[model samples]
Target chain A: MTAPVDVSLIVIVVVITALVFDFTNGFHDTANAMATSIATGALRPKVAVLIAGVLNVVGAFLSVEVARTISSGLVDEARISPVVIFAGLIGAIIWNLLTWLLGLPSSSSHALFGGLIGATVVAAGLGAVHFGAVLSKVILPAIVSPVLAGIIALTATYLAYRTTARADSGTVTKGFKAGQIGSASMVALAHGTSDAQKTMGIITLTLITAGVLSPDSGPPFWVILSAGLAIGLGTYLGGWRIIRTLGKRVSEIETPQGFAAEASTTAVILTSSHLGLALSTTQVATGAIFGAGSGRRLAAVRWSVARQMVVAWILTLPAAAAVGAVAAWVASAGTVGIVLVAVVAIALAAGIYAVSRRRPVTADNVNDVGDDAAVAHEPAVPAR
Target chain B: MTIDWASLGLVSVVSLAAGVAVVVLVSFALVGLSARVRPRPGGAEDGAPTLSAGAGTAIAAVCLAAVVAIVGFGLYVIVS
Candidate 1:
């Protein structure tokens, strides 16, 4: 480890970058919990995000098991430096912005893991990454959780429709809308429990590498509080672009379908969080939404849109890893190199934001599918 | 490094079961509510329902209570 005095400055810089990444994570994933709720008119856009933001804060205080996993289990803290963690954060934030610009609901968790693993490999060699842990905890869970969520949602949605087939349509819609609000709130809370801890773990790992904290220590109370607030703030801002895609472009979500999708997402995310598995909330939500679509009728699903999201999922890890590796190489040269990387990252982020402003999607225009000609032109899925 | 296949299996089974159960219960509750005969807004005479309205209301209440209990249990698992 480096001398404590020499590394303290680097540690502070790294922590801020991690918080920035956490902020992007918050907005990038806001759609996962609230998209269907917003789309179905169960809650207004502003009210939905406010509720999600508060619940996320409450959920962040729920458990520390996942934090322990990221701090010590993923990569060797001794081999990597705070600078490396900073580079990894840069990679994740950039990937998140790129995907968000394209309105794709990619996995923020996977991007973080990929960036960290990639930067570690470049800085400390391949052995620094525990491939075994990655296989069991990260890779395997990513594959299974989404498929499982999809199947459960499919069955539940089908059963839901069948059970209520003879019911008065007006009463059924009202009841399911009420149920959807409860389920969506649970999903938001579950998201806070899982996603916020990834940042906490990265910050804790940075502190450990700086010689400020011992190895394998859990996040301090302050770390948890700041991480929670950062994410909550991001959630409140909302990711209207991705929300539009998930809510309107995925399929026409009825009240029952929305309820089923949110419930399945809640169950899978909470279960994984309890087990300390860092599964992707985005994937689970996407899968459940598709499942809900398919359950109603295979014809009801827009397979082309689903195909595009899956392609994004397949690319997120490798793409983020590549950027992270390049960033680590550049940042490792010296203090000057680190400053250059930070400058370039900020410039690139500003450029992306400028581009996004050209055809902006905000809460007022989020559900305006008819006015947005591009979204309207997509071939419609025939509802059964 | 070693994959805990057992834990993986447990998570998968539990999540799937819980997801399906919650949906089913909520749907059944809605169905039960629909079965009950609500007095019309214009004060029309209530039509006789196939199932007794009292029984349907009872069934709906029980199912909704079960869903609430499960959600509470989920919250407890997170905190403790």
Candidate 2:
């Protein structure tokens, strides 16, 4: 990497690829923070995304601690080449687009980490993969974070309904709607502080592998700014399809339910990250909405849709890892391998985008009648 | 390495406590403020006892301020 100029080019491609993943991560997760707000009319579809976009950029600049861990603590960074990273990024980006096209809100963090681990195992040996750290940092948190979030949201939703039972219904709606704005914004801001850093971590690890930065160095200013801006722009675009799935398909959220879900999301995300555990914001938010929906009546919730999301969450890691393993095997051939992976990834992404347009779900149609929504419930599946 | 169940436990406990506190306080604030609004002719609240304006405002203010403080702490956790 020090002598070969091609390695630097690969590093640049890896950085760009990481930003693209960040972009998908942003739109893929817009549902997590803004879906409830949009669903309950607390904020207009456009305004909710606008505020989330701005808060995400502000939040990205707030911290770098998370970036450091993803760069060094997860794997033997010293053994990885920049091309390995590029392959991993491609795997992650492909999975993200595929899930988005289906309108399933999968865990982007799991995909990213899975891709990296897969590439590392293929490029380096099994010894280079730190199983202990993966177990503690990745596997355990995935199981624990969402369940904890769901429990908190369930309790919060019950308490809100019970306490406000005697109040005027209209008054309750108004108060909770006002409260929704704050809680949803907190989740958005917390999202920025958390998910944005994962990209920064990948880029920093790339720089270190390429010999552009010393070992253990944090992400440079340029890396942070680009990651933040890319995510912010994507957030503004809004993932209308997934938003519809979570907000409308999962349950018809009332203002009180929306506030409970968003507040629980904020609390769990902030507390977990503060304690040096960066759980998937997507899982936490999804579980909160599920819990909020269940708190009122089990009959109202569309359990089938919730079940679909759980299946997606379960498949995210292994699917991305499989793709990443194949890509890493190809990319080991040197510059030819990197370019090949990049071209194939771009083609697949473009294909997914094209297929999504067949039954477009923009902000306008995002909240149509729930009986036959177009999100993933469309009985026909075109080969994605 | 053994799983750090204790850290996970701490996150669950603190998040639940903080999340419930915020929701309850906001609900109370809503109840108190609604109690201050004079009952309209044929309104649903016509039969319920309305709190005095002073007591209603004080309760609403206190409850809302507590929510704000909790939110402020959340912000601190993110930034600091």
Candidate 3:
């Protein structure tokens, strides 16, 4: 038999590349957790992002059990190639940018999972997929986690207002804003623990497959540092498009609602992370926001906006997978194929950026979108 | 079926727990500090930073550093 591949170089490259994706994940999804607070004027924009960046780093250290899930549970690590992972990252990055440009709060978790699943299926056939892990660990959690968070937030919001019914509006707002600081931080910590590890796991899996590292090995120091730094920097840049959508469109978040929503989200996210569940923080946060709104009143939640976000959520996995599968198919043609995919992805990104310049959405213009604004400024119904 | 728990870095685990404790404690402290500093009608403190944004950022940073260090060490052990 041929000697094992000298995977050291590939490991180094894939680890760094994975970190690049982690960093993008951080910036891309920051809006999912903090947009509502920023939109409500609960936190200054810069201050909000800086805090998220730091917490994301801290959270990354909390657990690696989820990383294990990603490394071993998602696919048969024995059968894949580093090139497949690279192509999948490209697919994910492209989808993330496309959705981000339109200011949609799509699920980054789903995108990553989709990318892995797609690449594995294309590279090694469907037998490589761990359906049990996909279902019990990823898919089921994705569906149930958000709904559970929403229910908890709804109950908490209902109680929060009831207990303070005699208090004046000013008193309630002030109290909850004070409480919000603690709850929000918990969510951030939980987010880092849950999300950053995906990259770590992927990199580790790449190392194992390429024979650069043992099968039982965890992510290396460089992998962890690079992933954390990348995500931290991304978090600092902030994804303002999504921030407006989540912060303003879902609900008019008063202080009490914000407090309850944040508290419930923290509880749900932390519990999931500890259990090694790879649930989407975006879904949990959004569900909590919706529950908080409904707790106040039926009309408090903008159903139209919620519908649009749901549609994006439903499309995230399938769309990213389709892109990844196509990229994998093309890349299978070897070096020329890889070059073509890269070129097309780069061109698509540039084109999206050019179109976005027409109505630029920066931190400055993030909050400018009004309540009636449709998803991507076009009318769309909920996909699910 | 035995697990080598030592290789997992128990210190890192404790560090993570400590970080969470610190966030919770600091949040309570901040709220109290804001209460002492800001004088509003009905004693409501509006200036306190929302826990989700500020605390979230701090926690994320800490976790990132920890993960980097732990994974870095893991790499060293495996590579050597």
Candidate 4:
């Protein structure tokens, strides 16, 4: 066994890194709940994020389910060292930051899972990983969840427009805008419960591997508290770039479309949760918006932007896995190796943030996509 | 490992029923309430009232109540 000091220090570093990943997850996914409401002027950007942040914290406290077994079925936890988990986290954070820089809505959960899989294979070999679980849990849901949500959104949107077709256009818009606020709030609250729980699980998993906690033990109060606050703070900060991509660049959303998309997202997420199918909120939200946009007018949907998102979704797992493999090699060197990896990871994150400042997207102009953002990803999207 | 095909199918059905129900109920409530408008001369939808004010408001109230009930049920499911 390693020295006592080394074990404790590793535990501390792992916990801190886990919380940092949680924060990024919160901010990266803010668009899932608020983008549509913000796009249609149903809720102010600042107010929308505030609601999401508070609800996320509240939701975290609401559930104390088994977080220690987050990757139990996907990988052999017994062979996973704290250093391996730390390396995995570094990979996930790097991917989350890179995707955020590009204003893409890739799955944060998948990044985390992919990182763990990559690190585990490097640390314990291919036999330790579960390919069947990966196919059924990670890859299948990534492909299926969005398609299901999109279909529902399409049907819901079509019915919404059809039933309201005869009503006063002005009244219809006003009514749906009000409805958007309620549905969007539910999404925010639901996001809080699920996403925040993942962080708590990671922290608990780290403790288990580090010998600080036994297997199958629930997260302690402090783990839950810190995870919740970290995620809440991140959500409050908001990922404005991704919000711009989802709200403005996805489609020209009207109030009715926003309402339909949000409602569909909420319904799919809630139903999946009840049925024990874990899906990514980012993917689900994007699909709902896609369906809503095309349901109203196929011509309004930007195919180029859709293609870019698809590319990002397809690349997320492999890219994060590649990074994780590299980090695993470096971290396996010993305690000193992780400190070096952490330092480099922090510097890279700072560089990404610095690059993003070149064309900042804040709450005031979040709905208006910049010409460069559109032209780079999609030339067909004219400056709004 | 086998995929949870049964759960996935159930999710699709439940989501469709829940999502479509909410959208339809809200639309109906809006339509019902629109009948109560006084119909100003310059308004885009200036026309004779399609239904009595009492009847329109009652329909809107019932539809909106159903929506609220459905949303409440959703909350219960989420919590449990």
Q: Per-prediction interface RMSD?
A: 2.6, 1.2, 10.1, 1.4
Better of 1 and 4 by lDDT: 1
Q: What lDDT does candidate 3 reach at residue A57?
A: 83
Residues A288-360, model 1: lDDT tens digits: 9989888888877677788889899989988888888888999999898889889999999999999999989
Candidate 3 CAPRI classification by DockQ? incorrect
C-alpha local distance difference test of each model: 0.87, 0.87, 0.69, 0.84
Tell me the tens digit of each residue's lDDT in model 2 across A1-384: 133354567777888999999999999999999999999999999999999998899889988868887888778988988878887888888899999999899999999988887888899978888889989998889988888888888889889989988776777899999999999899989999899999999998988887877888888888889999989888889999899888988887888989999999999999888877868999999999988887666565677887888899999988898888889999999889878888889899999999999989998989874456543453322211
Docking class of 1: medium
> What ranges in model 4 sit over 4 Å off?
A1-7, A65-69, A370-384, B40-49
lDDT score for residue A375 of model 2 = 35
Q: Each model's DockQ?
A: 0.59, 0.78, 0.04, 0.69
DockQ of 3: 0.04
Model 3 gets an lDDT of 0.69
Give the lowest summed-lDDT range of ten residues in model 2 chain A. Answer: A375-384
Model 1 preserves the real interface contacts to a fraction of 0.79
Kindly give the stretch of ten consecutive residues in candidate 3 chain A with the minimal lDDT sum: A375-384
How many steric clashes between backbone atoms does each model show? 0, 0, 42, 0
lDDT of 4 at B54: 82
